[model samples]
Target: MTRNKLRLAIIGAGPAGIYAADILLKSERHFDVSIDLFDHLPAPYGLVRYGVAPDHPRIKGIITALREVLDRGDIRIFGNVRFGEDLTLDDLKRHYNAVIFATGAVRDASLNIPGIDLEGSYGAADFVSWYDGHPDYPREWPLEAQSVAVIGNGNVALDVSRILAKHPEDLLPTEIPANVYEGLQRSPVTDVHVFGRRGPTSVKFTPLELRELGELRDVDMIVHDEDFDYDDAARAAVAGNKQVLVIDKVLQQWRQREVGSASRRLHLHFFAKPVEVVGDEHGQVAAFRWERTAPDGEGGVVGTGEIREIPVQALYRAVGYYGSPLPGIPFDKRLGVIPNHEGQVLIRDKESGKSRQMYGVYCTGWIKRGPVGLIGHTKSDAMETIKHVINDLGNWWRPESPSEESVVELLESRGIRWTDLDGWHRLDEHEQALGAAEERARIKVVPRDEMVSISRGEV
Candidate 1:
């Protein structure tokens, strides 16, 4: 084995990408190693930058740590560059010794139902993106709505509803985009309902997120007593689990207060499955036709035929995120991922049962293993995959025959424009300036064009 460092290209700048870069940059074998970090957004920190709720300052602090990693002299960051769109897999394989795909699952799972195409129906991802001021989403909170129904009971559903029910004064201090804050200040909605097809015991919200709902001053919280008819054993099973218990406690606390005087309402409805989304004359969601459901005694749910309709103008679906196919990667439609053995991108010969290795191509994050784990899980995953890549570096990088693919040349030839590390500094300055002008925490540009133009010196 030669005493040479490996040249690596990491495809995403989120937790997995940043953590992997951190591991490589901090390694003892620094002599021949270099890294190029690529991201579609001008800014990095994948989910922490766009996916996380704006009010969550604690989680957003991870961005600062990631910035330090990018500051390392051995690393190069290419922002506003997408793999499929700008850089191809073939291109990536040639440019770097090994490429790590950390492009996260950004799409939301669809709820296939009639009238889902209605104007008011929105994916939780889109709603979060809009309010979080993700540069891609046009600046606006569609809260002129009178009522909203969020389908699915997860932390994200809670996040969407909480932001809706929260008073503008309570949210203003947070880093929400100015336009979102303004639209929310005039929200017409009086009630926001969070729904679940299952009972409270199966709800996926964390205790920290559940408790935050209690601090909302403008909205009244409610959980129907009928939602919890679980046997004594089931109740005892969840008694110590803080997340489930927090929901129980919050429901109890809200029940004690007189509810009518509250300006807005946040209702938690369980055992309800949406049968159909009812639309108005103008093709907007007017109401949701929900059927009561209960456990079918075999870990399944059965509807009780009892139906109820609730008026609503907007809906957010937070079921889950699903992966999409990337160019030049073997995609498994059923699994919503590129088939992999550990972190190596697995490609199988169609005629034979044998698996072929796609050399210099690796994957991490939700796309590698199904999108299930939290942010911290990515670190261990990236490390494991990175070990494998680092081990195989000898096959690619060599002193005499070092690969000749230059990222700068490739980008220039394709007319795929991007900003180098210095360009990101300018974008950073612009965002900080916007935040300063607003007298709030870091303000963000939520439009893709704005970010691209700013990096291109058009702004």
Candidate 2:
């Protein structure tokens, strides 16, 4: 007998997966839909809760909308549920009719260069994780460098630069926990240099983030005169795009401002492509070397062979975020995304190079399309996946036990102490209360077990 309802399991509880559930509910499908969201962490939001910097409250505001969706009492959420470990493909096969993987990328995209693995060198993603109170990363960070080099021009590069250069006192207003504030307070950092491979107009930075970089308290912004030689292509970009124009206006304003006498200084270097990370005798970061690049008149740059080396103890590579392959999913290692056509996962036969859909398996967000746009792009991404779910309803799994009660019973049998929506409420209130005592918005809980305990109302 055909079932009257659809049991859907979304592997991530972040914006991507939540958005997919929301779209499914609003879809004009004939069958009833039941969604269950699962996250590996005790919390729901993936990167929004862990990968985002502490000072970016505006970006974090997307949580309000996501929270509304989860709180609607229609969709169920299970926290601390690892897909491959706690719940396997066999488990999902029995419980749900279809599954969507929205596991967004967290690993840093590799930056291939000599001596890139020095002790003082780090990935910007790990730094963001540390400041955001991600429980998995170590609580301590080494902020011993007086001069630091940040290689990249995106928002993440700016974030790492701002956090390293800003006085620790300025970070007190954010939601960063006590440990992060204390770690930053001990920092001896004075000058932070940011390098970009392309010219100013060709930067990947958004106008808002670029402007915010100029507003850091007591920090002098420096843009070299040599880097301002914009080509015709650069000028065309500034004139054609409104966002590019605003960014150019800000950079030009900085160009005009007289260098002020501030204790900390942030230098923005454009048309500089990093070539090597020089290591000292002790195998620690000693300096950074890069080649000056010039526009090739084709919207790209060619190395000018003018190598420059800067003495710096620490370097952060903020190239990009790459996805992790799921245990049972067909992943394209080169692209760091599940092998998919549209949203339907396409698995290839190794011997024949043939392609076919893994029935009912779908992907969305960064895992689906690689890390590209912001939350707005994620909404449209989910639309693509859920559209397939509605159209390919005939291809969904026929579970042996599709009842919600059977799923609950299986979880209880496994000794999995998973968290539900009510548990999240408890943890949320606890964090808010902690922040209230300190006269701040919220103080994030940093321990996995502690978060689970609070969510379970054990303490």
Candidate 3:
């Protein structure tokens, strides 16, 4: 009387999905369990490929460790397969004993501002996707502007600001597609502004990322004195940190240099909320109308009667990423998460008790939780979800008929060539080769056409 091995399909090849697979594959009790991981991109490593800034090769190296887990005999990698688009939730439930939706949030939260729909206004996701060489984005980008306004204070904003500040020779090393790389080299934009509604303490950027702003030998980092007026708690966040102290020292240096410089500038502005985006006659953003804000004593911004006008030709709303509705899963639109207790997927009617009607349907990462936390934080969140999944394995192993389809078979039948560990190795080599050709670290293939051709057989 041996227990049945669980059949699992983890949709999403991001950090959460990869970590979940890693843990499950390593667990002795789950030796018999099999996993088929799916991702929309031809290449694996979701955010690692698309979200992280191109220049940060060290952060992208996490893929090497993930590649180890993927090499395990029981785990399969299915790239270039979209979950909801190619296969339905019900379709997945019909095949595997359990399905884990680790699909990371894909879309950005829209700013519903008056002129946000203008041609020059873009979301941070698009901005990132463009520069990072996401296959879906076009190779040509709009870089012929003088000033750009990015509305967020997160690491992403920092990344965008850093790239904008990079000298062309420095940028030549990363895998930016030829056209984007050329466009950036010819970029007319010299000033970048990252705006936040709150003070520096409430900013989503970690201290490490903030310090990178000072690394630019050619770019000036400017912080208005007015923006640093934090209240007690907010002040405490910066008082004792070595990184914060470094940031303070860097800003002090930047202040001394801000008076007159011809170099590109990365300006961090706080306590200002965009009330409206002013657009030119051609429907491109020309400037921004912002209202002054002060701390309301309870970790929020309160509007002041003061107003400020800043000239801008480009804008990106990097407020945050949001989750989209998945079929058959209960979604909480307000919270941007699927309804669940701990890590257990909760049914609308069965909220009072744990229900296992659907055998292997589960969720992890941003889709299960919400788009929050850094990559390291995803490990703990994934572990909690795996615990619930392992506990619920009993119900899926009953004496009834077994699932007929698994993610691997469906992908194979559809002619989707998912890269195994060896295949990814080849891609890694190819990317490095391309990088060498450009005399840069690694040049990314940004166009979807090129990514598809390379993944398929054209390259």
Candidate 4:
């Protein structure tokens, strides 16, 4: 008796989704297994390719590991395939034994301030996408600001501030697209203000990210002298937690440095809670208003009722990233995640007043949990989801067409111009070729049609 093939479909070709596919294939199994990774874009590695900063090749190294998994011939990738639009829940149920929604968050979490809608105000996620050469975003960014405000203390805020303040010529060594390079080159930005709502010891920045701010050539690191007023709890955190200790040490070193007249300045402002974005007569961002905050004895901070405003032509809200809801999935709009219990997708049952697992459905990554934790933490998250997935194999979907050929036929029938693993290889080689000619690492292809055309050998 021959064992049956276990077919799986994963939405989102980001790190989380790629990890899930890799783990499942490597795991001990009772039957033969196969996976098909899907993404809306023609390329794979969703956020890793599109969300990361261009200058930080260190963080982007995760893609090499992800590439190894995709290179394996056992797994197939269907690119430029949108889940809800190209293939629905019904379509997935007809083909695969399991479906995992690993659609990580991309949209910026709402700031809900008085002047957040001003012309010069933007979401850091969008800026990241623009600079990373995402095909979907506009080619040109309005980098017309002289002074900018970044409202977050996380790694993302740091990335934005660094990119805005750093000389455009410095980014040329990386994979920065020509259009993005041109935009930054013309930017008149001199001061970049990074605001954290908590005290010095309570920032969300990693040790490496914080230290990198000071390393930017010709950019001065500015930390307000008063923001260092650490409370008893904050002081204890610095003495105890290893990460917090390193972060505090970096800030202290910056505070002691004598001020120099650098062409650009990157300011680190702690104990500042964003109150509003003040708009100018033309409804563009004129200034940023924030209230001073104090440590509230615990790990959190309380507003000090001291409002201050800074002159800034632009603002970026990097508070958080939120997930987009799928057509059939039950999403918690407030939390920006799918309702899941340890990776099993759940739906609220009106009669029982509780959530029950939606059979044959699961989730992992930022879509399952909120947008928190580092990329390394994603493997553990995938492991949790995979455990339930393997144990509950008996509960897998009974598909009408489980053969791999059926999915191809369905896609062709719908006229979906889906690119396979081979297509990704073509696109990858093309990017490298383009980069080699420019004497750089890799210049990313930005237009959607151009990427798809290259992948399909139509160009």
- Top model number, lDDT: 2
Q: Can you write out model 1's per-residue Cα lDDT over 1-459, one digit (the tens) per residue? A: 244656677888888888888876665553576788899888778888788998889988888887887776567888888888898766665555678888878788888888888998989988888888777777765676888999987888988888888887787667777788888888888889999998777777777888888778867777777776776644764676766677666666766777767888889898899888999899988998889998765445789999999988888888888887888888888778778777888899979978877777788888888778887788888888877776766555333323434677778788876876777777778888888887877787767778877877887
Q: What is the per-residue lDDT of model 4 for residues 289-351, given as tens digits with 9 covering 90 to 100?
A: 999988889989888899999999999999999999999999999999999999999999989
* Per-model RMSD to reference: 2.8, 0.9, 3.0, 1.5
Against the unseen true structure, what C-alpha lDDT does each candidate score?
A: 0.79, 0.92, 0.75, 0.91
lDDT, candidate 1, equals 0.79
Q: Which candidate tops TM-score? A: 2
Model 3 lDDT per residue over 1-459, tens place: 126677777888888899998887666574377677878787788888888887787898998787777766566776777777677766665666777778888788878778988888888888788887787877777886789898887887788878777776676667666776787888887888888888666777776787777777677777788766668766665686666655555555656664446478888888888888999898889998888899887778899979898999988888888888777787878878876765567666566665444445678899877888877778988888888778876755332323434445766777765555455656666777888876866766655555656665567
- Candidate 2 backbone collisions, by pair: none
Cα distance off (Å), candidate 1, residue 17? 0.9
The list of candidate 3 runs beyond 4 A from truth reads 28-31, 229-231, 240-246, 297-299, 350-359, 397-409, 447-453, 456-459
| Model 1 ranges off by over 4 Å | 1-3, 27-31, 240-242, 296-300, 394-405, 453-459
Name the lDDT value of residue 44 in candidate 3.
82
- Runs of candidate 4 exceeding 4 Å displacement: 1-3
What would you estimate as the lDDT of candidate 4? 0.91
Q: What is the TM-score of each candidate against the true structure?
A: 0.91, 0.99, 0.90, 0.97
Model 2 agreement with the true structure over 240-302: per-residue lDDT tens digits: 999999999999999998777889999999999989999999999999999999999977999
Candidate 4 or 1, higher lDDT: 4
